[model samples]
Target: MITLAEAREAYRGYAPTYDLLFGPLLQRARRRAIRAANDRPGQRVLEIGVGTGLSLPYYRPDVRLVGIDVSAEMLAKAEARARRCGLAERCQFQLMSAEAMAFADDSFDLVVALFVASTVQDLGRFGAEIGRVCRPQGRIMLVNHFSTPAGLSARLDRQLSRFAGSLGFEPYFPLDRFLAETGLRVTASAPAGLFGRLRLIEAGKG
Candidate 1:
C-alpha cells in the first residue's frame, strides 16, 4: 500500500510536470466524469484529489465547487490554475485529505474523485468519508482504472502493482473489491478514455 507521505512526496515531484505528463492522457476521462456529475445550478460539489485543478473548467460554471488535496505542491498549482482560469466565482480550494476531510456531514450534493481511489493508503476510510459528506440521495462519481476480472489483463495488473509505490497509484485495483471495501453501490458505470482503460462510475448515497 502507498502511504500518504509517499504519495505526497511523489506528487510533489510530479507537480512540476503533472499537467504536461497526465493532462492530455487523462483529459478525456476528466471531461467525462465532470459531465456525468450532472451538477445543477447552486448545487455544492466537492472534488477530492483535485490535482492542479485540471478538472475545474469542466464543471458547470453555475455550481459551487470545493476542491481538496493532500499534496500541497499540487494544490498550489491548482490554486494558480483556478486564478488563471477565473474559476473563483464557481470554485474554492482546501488542502485536505480524502480519508479525513474536515467538512461537516452531508456537506455536498455531488462528490467526485477522479484517479484517486487506488492512491490512498486506506480505501475503507476513503469510502466512508465520501459517503459521510454526501447528503442522502446525493451522487458520488469516480473515474479510475480497475483491474479486470481475470485473464492476461489481470496478470498484467498484478505485475504492474509491484511498482505502485514509485508509480504512486496501484495498478491492480479490482472493481468488485473496491465496491465491497468502499461500500459504494454503482448507480451506473461505463467505459471511458483511451482504449476503455478508464472507468466512469456513478453511485447514489441512498
Candidate 2:
C-alpha cells in the first residue's frame, strides 16, 4: 500500500506537470462527477484529493466548496485555480488527508472524489470518512478507474497495478468491495471518460 508520505512526494513531483498531462485526459471524468453532484445554492461540498482544483470551475459559484489534498504543492495549484476562476470566495483549499478529515459529523451536503479512490491507502477508512461527513440523504460522487468484473479492462487494470506507485494510484481497486466494506450504497453509476475506462458513481451515506 502507498503511504501518505509517499503519495505526497509523488504528487509534489506531479504537481508541475499534472495539468498538462492528466488535465485533458481526465477532464471529462471530472466534469461527470461534478454534474452527478447536482449541486444547489447554499449546499456545502467537500472535494477530497482536489488536486490542482481542476473541478473548481465546474461547480456552481453559489455552492460552497472545500477542497482538500495531501500534497501542499497540489493545493497551491488548486488555490491558484480558484483565484483564476474568480472562485476564491466560494472555494477553499487545504492540505488535508482523505483517510482522516477534521470536519465534524454530517458537515457536508455532498462529498466528491475524482480519480482519487485508487490512491487512498485504506479504501474502507476513506469511504467511512466520506460517509461520516456527508449528511444522511446527501450525495457522494466518485469518478475513477476501477477493476471491471472480468474483461479486457480488468486485464488492463491488472497490468497497470504493478506500476501504481509511479502512476500515483492503484489501477485495480475493486469498487464493489470498497462500497460494501465502507457501508456506502451506490445509487447510480455510469461509464465515463475515454473508452469507458472510468466510472461516474453517485451514492448516499448508508
Best model number under TM-score? 1
- TM-score between candidate 1 and the true structure: 0.95
Candidate 1's residue-wise lDDT over 89-201, tens digit each? 67888989999999999999999999999999998899999999999978999999888888898899999988888888998989888898888878899998667678899
Candidate 1 differs from the real structure by a C-alpha RMSD in angstroms, to one decimal, of 1.3
What TM-score would every model get versus the actual structure? 0.95, 0.94
What residue runs in model 2 are displaced by over 4 Å at the alpha carbon?
none
What are the runs in model 1 whose C-alpha is more than 4 Å off? Answer: none
lDDT of 2 by residue, 1-206 (tens): 57787789889999999999999999988876787584577789999999999998788878789999999999999999999999899888888898999999999999999988889888889889999999987899988876777988888888987877877888787777667766778889888967766888888887
- Candidate 1 at residue 21, lDDT? 96
Question: What C-alpha lDDT values do all the predictions have?
Answer: 0.88, 0.86
In Å, residue 122's CA in model 1 sits off its true spot by 0.9
